[model samples]
Target: PDFKPLPKTNQSVGIDLGITDFAILSDGRKVDNQRFTTKMEQKLKREQRKLSRRYEQAKKDNRDVRECKNYQKQRMKVARLHERVAFQREDFLNKRSTELIRHYDPICIENLNAKGMLKNHKLAKAIRDVSWSMFIEKLMYKAKWYGRNIVKIDRFYPSSQLCYVCGHRDGKKSLEIREWTCPACHTPLDRDVNASRNILAEGLRLFETTQP
Candidate 1:
């Protein structure tokens, strides 16, 4: 299966991965992020609370928690919820990566510093829920299996801040500034769209450097 090379195509895509959506592709496509954790959080907390209460009750009764039926049953229920979330995320990533591999050549994405991003307490939960690192790993492994290429542009490339239409660095933008017009060309830009285009350009540049 790994031996079959992908069909030659003139397509190269840059993807901007984010918490709000799965990815923003350079080809004007947006894949919505599956917020699995957020969807299951309430249910998980309920199950966990039940398990905790059972543990506390067992302790109060001077009973061995291992020998307690309620404690054990609640524990298993909570465990299954966690497993469901994990499986759902994996399934989504696998399908998305496979589709991308089949279509695009030399996919480009940011070399994001997830660890550093997580340090922001306000955004930590959102960042953790998206699982960027895991998604990238899945995309990469599938790319190798199918004999495709992936490019990781430098983390500090400023994909969002720079104008894709005219090589102009407008300035740093806050997360809230989702849309802006380029000062140089007066070209209207959607933040993610411009970033995707820039990513595609960078990925293609990197690919050329590796070729004989």
Candidate 2:
């Protein structure tokens, strides 16, 4: 199919990506994290255990594991479980990316260091399940296909730390601190929403400077 640019809209958005919520928009809308992998984890584990038992049974029977019909069948079941999870996650990412491109002219987001983030063992699994890198890739390609712009703010930007209302540079806040009142402006803020707004502001600023 020949791809055509979508009709332009005045709408622009900044997105903050997180594990709690898949994405938080500057407009205060949140896309809930589906946790596809986690949801399927138990079933997958059971199937894998069954596959292992089948393999062990094959070994005891003096049959090649690869040649054992029961082992192969169980292996395929485990493989299908993994495939289902991957497909679900990919479908979700594709839909969200396309929806954003269709509605927004210039989408802004923070340049996340996903690899560095995965270094935290406690967060690695959750982060992988969210598949931030894959989502960003989809957004980038879809933006190009749909004639939308993707603006990425610097990774080093203190988006979550700064107050979006008064631009006060508050010190680091832990992940548990989801909401706070701005010390400078006394305005209440949702951490993710505030970060998104900051990203939008910074992205637009950068976009303006880059324009001829």
Candidate 3:
């Protein structure tokens, strides 16, 4: 049998979490948005409607409803729909996270303030679907199991606003501005990538300065 030691590096990968871009790796790698929940929402809703209708009919029939085979069949159908959606979402996340773990040696990602973000009513559903917390939890343990490191940077760091090329800070680029040309370096920026790069650079600097 042959065994090999993992590579030791003085570098790390940073990631930015979002809905438009599922993940942006610090080294300018873009992982496409795999909106598993968003894609299944419509179908799930339709199934829920069918389930609700069955429940309503059962209610109307009262004591006699429990004996009906059709009601029992519809109940099982609805349960299967829910099971399918859960599997789809779990499968997508597992695949994406596994790919990242395989590609990067040391991964760093922002410690997301999930509760704070949920306060924004408009983003609530989208945030819930992205499941940032779950992703981080899985990634952290996987990295440990594979002899890789997962670093959680502070949430307050301005990954998106800082120019990765020139370190220029621009306060004007808000959440609405998805893509922008950097004012300092004249480089085109994909918002997520720019943020991810900044995160990676900052993490490297932090790792060096703190000797972590």
Candidate 4:
């Protein structure tokens, strides 16, 4: 039996990127952090310890050469772990991007300059998890393959601080305030969700304005 064709429609979406949350959809849906890269932190530390011990033992024995079979095995083990972590991160990004492309058309996201964004010491991990640059890369290629659109708006669009329901912009909210009711509409605001909605709207407006 043949499968039905996928429907094509402009489904305006906003991807609010973060570390703990990864990406938030305009409709309040969340794609949790993959953390594949982070999952190896502990293991990597332990592996380092083992390598350290091996090196210490070699030094104590005054062996100018430590390329013994055991030493080679230990080095190979560390390399394998590094390889695994890289593969996991790639797999996570590919799967997540593909899912988003399949589900939504005209996916809108911020065009973030991640190198500058990562300079904030407080938001480093959160920024990394969002993986804005990697996500955008995957999103663009996948959208192209799927015949969908990936819309990128300015990073200063204020998606998070703007009230999507009332178009009221709050330029003063600190990053600490995760949830706040919109002063204008009294709507309970989810920082991530609200930002996503704003992103979606802004992207839609941009798309329509550019339409012939």
Candidate 5:
């Protein structure tokens, strides 16, 4: 099947991806983190436990585990549960990416080192559950297919630490500080939204300079 390029739109957006919220847009819209893995964790654990019990029973009966019908059934149940979670995550990402590509001409986002971020034990699970890398991959491919542009700002760009209104460097801030007033411009800022706006501004600047 042929896929025609989508019509161009004047709208552009910057997205700040986070564990708390899936994405915060420069337009002040937030898409909630669905946390599909977390939601299915308890059910998956239960199925896995059942699978283990089936394996143990097979061992006790001197039955070949591979040929044990009960064990195989339980194993399939556990596998299906895992597949469900994966499918749910993929569906959410696809819908969101398609919507963004259709509506926005150029989508801006930060270049995050997802692998490096996973090194933090405290945040690793949440980060993996969100599947930021998968989401970005979807956005990239969709953008190309739909004639939309996707801009990734530098990882060290300090989108959060800088004030979007006045470009004042606020230095480092803990994640706990979700809102702050910019000293330079005295403007109140929402952390994710502020970062998104800055990303948009920086992305446009870079895009313009690179254009022929």
Candidate 6:
């Protein structure tokens, strides 16, 4: 995969990431989250239950657990289920990152504190399932591999609170509030999309200032 280059383009885009939708783009596009873990949770639980029951039955029957055919079969079933989830996640991230790299000259995204975000127990599973860190890592290397640029806005930048219309920085709002009217510009904004646009603008500004 070395030395591969893509066609040149001056277009750029910014992305806002979320658990509901994998990404929302500055260009008004939404990449719906696959929610692989959520989708297959029931199936996985069933597989896990099968594995557990097999182990218990083996123990109760005084059989060597390792040599029990049923136990081994169920364990492999559970393991394969886990493997499937992992493979699906990687596949989705790869395709998503590749699409962005191919279509946009420069890709912009917020610098998220992933570890800090994971501290919220309620959000931990969903956040880890979405795997924002892994997605960004793929984007970084893929951008370089495909001759595209990738930019990250400062973690401190208030992308969500800033009004894309008039550069107004509004007071912080709770995550529950998805849509709001920007006070300064009276702009009706979808939180994620607005953030994406602001990220794009900020990223462009950074690139412009640094250019020769």
Q: Distance from true position, residue 205, model 3, in Å?
A: 1.6
Off by over 4 Å in 5: none
Predict model 6's lDDT versus the native: 0.91
Model 3 RMSD, rounded to 1 decimal: 2.9
In the range 1-212, model 6's lDDT, one tens digit per residue, is 57678998778999999989999999989999999999999999988988888888988999998899888988888889899999999999999988898899778899999999999999999999999999999999988888788889998999999999998999789999999998888999999999999999999988788779
Model 2 ranges off by over 4 Å: none
For model 5 the local lDDT of residue 100 reads 91
For model 2, residues 55-75, the per-residue Cα lDDT tens digits are: 888888888988888888888
Q: lDDT-based ranking, best first? A: 2, 5, 6, 1, 4, 3
Q: What is the C-alpha RMSD of each candidate to the true structure, in Å?
A: 1.2, 1.0, 2.9, 3.3, 1.2, 1.2
**After TM-score superposition, what is the CA distance of residue 186 in candidate 1 from its true location, in Å?**
1.0
Give lDDT tens digits, candidate 1, residues 73-153. Answer: 889899999999999988888889888989988899999999999999998998888888998998888888778889999
Per-residue C-alpha lDDT of model 4 across residues 1-212, encoded as one tens digit per residue = 44343468656578888776888999889988878657788898898788778877877887743565566677789999989977887888888998888888788888888999789987776677556788789888777666788889898877887899998887768777899988888999998988899999998888888779
Give the per-residue lDDT digits (tens) of candidate 3, residues 92-161: 7888887777777667789899989999999988888788888888887777666776767799998888
Question: In candidate 5, what are the lDDT values of residues 1-212, reduced to their tens digit?
Answer: 45788997899999999999999999999999999989999999888988999899989999999999889988988989999899999999999989899999789999999999999999999999999999999999887777788999999999999999999999999999999999989999999999999999999998888789
Which segments of candidate 4 are over 4 A away from where they belong?
1-7, 60-66
Q: How far is candidate 5 from the true structure (C-alpha RMSD, Å)?
A: 1.2
lDDT of 2: 0.93
Score candidate 5 by TM-score against the native. Answer: 0.96
lDDT of each: 0.90, 0.93, 0.79, 0.81, 0.93, 0.91
Candidate that scores best on TM-score: 2
Candidate 3 lDDT (Cα, 0 to 1)? 0.79
lDDT of prediction 5: 0.93
